[model samples]
Target: MTNEFVLEAITREFPESVLLHSEPYGFLTLEVKKQDIKKIIHYLQDSSLEINFLTDICGIHYPEFQEKELGVIYHLHNMMTNFRIRLKVFMPRENAEVDSLTELYAGANWMERETFDFYGIKFKGHPDLRVILNDPEMGYHPMLKEYKLEDGTRTDKDDKMFGR
Candidate 1:
């Protein structure tokens, strides 16, 4: 099956759930509503399209977007066909929560935890949701845009080590 076949299948299944569709780097990327993410992904996993592999799941932070400040990105692959597609569901930072995919894919457990540990995006109904990498005392999501990327106050020189 070709990429267009995959896109057509999704658009046909959930006409309204899809917010945007784009092909960048020849990869089909879809922006879908947060509420429909579970349904959409469940469909992709079971439908005749056979997009059954949960290749990766991650989170993104766009602090300036307000309503779309936080997002969860899912990469799916059809192992037999070697076709891959990406889906994203975004929501406001205040309500950075979505349905858990553990019910559908066991691998989602660690990926969700890592996303939560870094971006603070909560996966509702997850059996265990806690920090996997950072210390619980860290208190904030380090990947969020609210934090600075670099410290300008550094006086100690390490330029050579960084190839600067």
Candidate 2:
């Protein structure tokens, strides 16, 4: 439907959770409070909008950005009408725990894992939370702005280090 209709429904149904609404790039984006994510998801699922496809959920970290310290970006699609919406939940670096959407969407399984793997945003109640790409011993996330490469050098030690 229209962005105004969606915004009105969301604001009326969930006054506390819906933080902001924007129509950028001709798509409706709802900035939701992290704590009320489950409620919002349930509403979306039950609404006529039929946003059944959870296209992607990824994490973003902005060490210098002022608006938010960390963010979890969620993109959902309504396959019936081919409409889409993006929801972003902002969190501080110190307290970054948004309710897991896995219960609502099974496809969120690997998406959440990948977000955790790169941005270190923990997904509570995740069935199997582990490193998807990086070595288990790698403590720091390589995607973060603070991540540093070792002296910008490509030495033989690098090739031999991981047994490549």
Using TM-score as the measure, the top candidate is: 1
For this target, which candidate reaches the highest lDDT against the unseen true structure? 1
Model 1 residue 96 lDDT score: 92
Off by over 4 Å in 1: 155-164
Indicate the residue-level lDDT of 151 in model 1.
Answer: 67
Query: What TM-score does each of the candidates earn?
Result: 0.91, 0.86
| Cα lDDT for residue 156, candidate 2 | 41
Worst 10 residues of 1 by lDDT: 155-164
lDDT of 2 by residue, 1-164 (tens): 77787778888889988888888988999999898887887788888767778999999887776457889999988888787888999888888777788889998989998888888888889888888888879897777766444444756444335332
Off-target runs (Cα >4 Å) in candidate 2 are: 65-67, 148-164
Report lDDT per candidate: 0.91, 0.82
